[model samples]
Target: MDERHDPARARWAVAGLFFIVGIVISTWFTRIPQFKTGLSLSDAELTVALLAPTVGALTGMQFAGRLTARYGSAPIARVTIVLAPAALLIPAASGDLVTAFVGLLVFGVVDGIADVAANAQGVAVERQLRRPVLSGMHAAWGIGAIIGALSGGAAIATGLTVLQHFAVMAAVTVVLALVAGSQLLPAGVDRSQTDRESPKRTSWRTGWTRRVLALGLLGGAAMLCEGAISNWSAVFLHDELAATAAVASLGYSVFTVVETATRLVGDGVRRRVGPVPVVRVSVALAIAGLALVLLGSPSDIVWLAIVGFGLLGAGLAVLNPIVFSAVGHGSVQDTGSADTAGAAIAHYTTMSYGGVLAGPAIVGWLSGAMGLTAALACLLVPLVGIGLFARVTAAAEPAVAD
Candidate 1:
């Protein structure tokens, strides 16, 4: 069968890699305390070590566009998946804080490269297939997180050392990535290029540049909501609602499941409601969900958080794809070659990741001082703003070709 008709299969392949990624990233967090104990590192020292991933991600984002352009996304993705497991080994085996920090730094680089490649592939596939398929690709990442969290918990409970658990996960990730790499299309043919005609290139300095920047900022805000939920939802359930271990953990799990399901359905939602209206509706749902989490009764916090996160997921789902699609429009006009579309993907990704790092740190500070409930309440502000911008951006959107 022609690949365009079967893009879902490609998405599934990508999702499986994301699943391994989830295990690698989340499993280590549970082992953080154990690592600190083993390494005899101070909290301040651990905090500095933890920043390795963010720093690495920022650095990787700067060059991923050119790397993907030159080497193609497939090679970068395959290599990253193979190397990601190595990151898990260091902290698991280390007797010193420095080793653990080195592990995280390496993990960060692997994660960053994989992230850029996967998203570039997603955009390329979606444009070729001429449908909104990126959300489902992301939904795979959410599913992977659930798997990671559960696996990590089980390993911890089973008395498996961090090293042992990570080693197992690494082996699994390497095998899966290698298998998936076989199926992925070459980025050159896989990518969308309207024509081979080379047009004058536009720099990121003026004209629609401001608009692109604005879109990036808005995209970053959406990412903040996602990052915040991932990092802090469990803490909120535990401290605010007084939930038990199993019950509290459900906060993130429930959110992830709901988010994944809704995202699978997001393309349909956009097709029926139109992209702008869907975004508006999603933002409203997020507000309601946030309100429910902050003000709902103890019996309902989990369900409320689930609903809010679902709304958050659904609402935020289309933003990234839509933003890239918009950038593709600009690039096509400027460069007369749609392959340059991936550059827009790079720009927006950098912007969104800025929020990915900042969101957790910001909320951690708020939760420390003003409390979790207040931090959750602050999320509503961005949701409301997204609703407003959805209207303006929707009105301004270039006509979608059939």
Candidate 2:
């Protein structure tokens, strides 16, 4: 990295951006109760309204590729810097269902854009710095989520309204994001930063080649499991396993801690082992973890479920990072595509969130037909498939950047 680019600073900037994105989204999650109460919404109505973000997010991601391809990651990231944080006001600053839905839809769109753009920026930082940083960047997001949740708790305790809490956080996020956005690598660095041979592959279509598609599938599968586990773990423990609500809550808590811890150390592990080994190991752990869940399902054992969720977190923690790194590095080398990596990352991210959005609904449908046990057990199918296609992405991970 050139002294002018200040690769180390740029890396932190991206990390900060990641945190900003995570915290803003988490802020929304933490306030669902307020939204429900303030709007006088029924449970079913809230569920339907919550779907707006997912739909809007998908729409936003579909266009982010083209936007980044034309304007570069830095510019798009800066756009998110303003839009995502500021858009927080939309969802809760409403009086009617139609208005709230529109607000959330717009929020989801901007959030989706921010998600892709921030990741693309992270990729640029990795390439410019010539090492692995994506995991750590993701770790920042996790950390931010923790803070967001805690802050939300505080706000609730202090009797702040939803709008008041969101407004304050939104302001803070915009200020912080501006600082981070300023330090992002200048436009075009994602394409220009390279230490390896390049120019062999041309066109953004390279983003959708078989290898990239395979990586996308793997990422989607992992996130699908995450969505299912996150949304259902407590329910499973409380209802299926006959645990107390307090104990049931520990399921997701364990998963979150394990996932965050794994992400914290994942970069060093990836630096030592290659991406292939990292992914392969992830596949094994995820499968073993889910198997443990199945083993405990026959009986009402809460500890078994808790342990299973922890392992599942460990297994799923690093796969998405690996996928993102592979796609970003691949695009850097294949400079022929204007934003080949951007386009590809957008697709991968879209599929990933789609998995999360769809996972719960899919499980619900399956549960109706075959019971929740069989439904969750069905996740193993994708985990095994992830193992089969682990090598598709050409991720020859480089050593840690100094």
* CA-lDDT, candidates in order: 0.68, 0.80
Root-mean-square deviation of candidate 2? 3.9
Give the Cα error of residue 363 in candidate 2, in Å: 2.1
lDDT (10s digit) by residue, model 2, range 1-402: 455468789888889988887788788899998899999999999998998988889998887766666667888888876787677687678888899899888888987888888888787777656678899889889889989999999999999999999889988988998888888887775442331234433333546766567677888888898999999888877767888989989989899889988998998888787788888898899888888877887596668878989999999998888888887676555544435677788888887887887778888889889988889999988888888888864553532332
Candidate 1 structure quality by residue, lDDT tens digits, 101-131: 7777877877877777777666555554556
Residue 11: error of model 2 in Å?
1.3
Give the TM-score (vs. native) of candidate 2.
0.92
lDDT of 1: 0.68
Q: Which ten residues in a row have the lowest lDDT in candidate 1?
A: 198-207
Show model 1 residue runs off by greater than 4 Å: 1-8, 190-208, 237-247, 297-314, 317-334, 364-375, 391-402
Residue pairs in collision within model 2: none
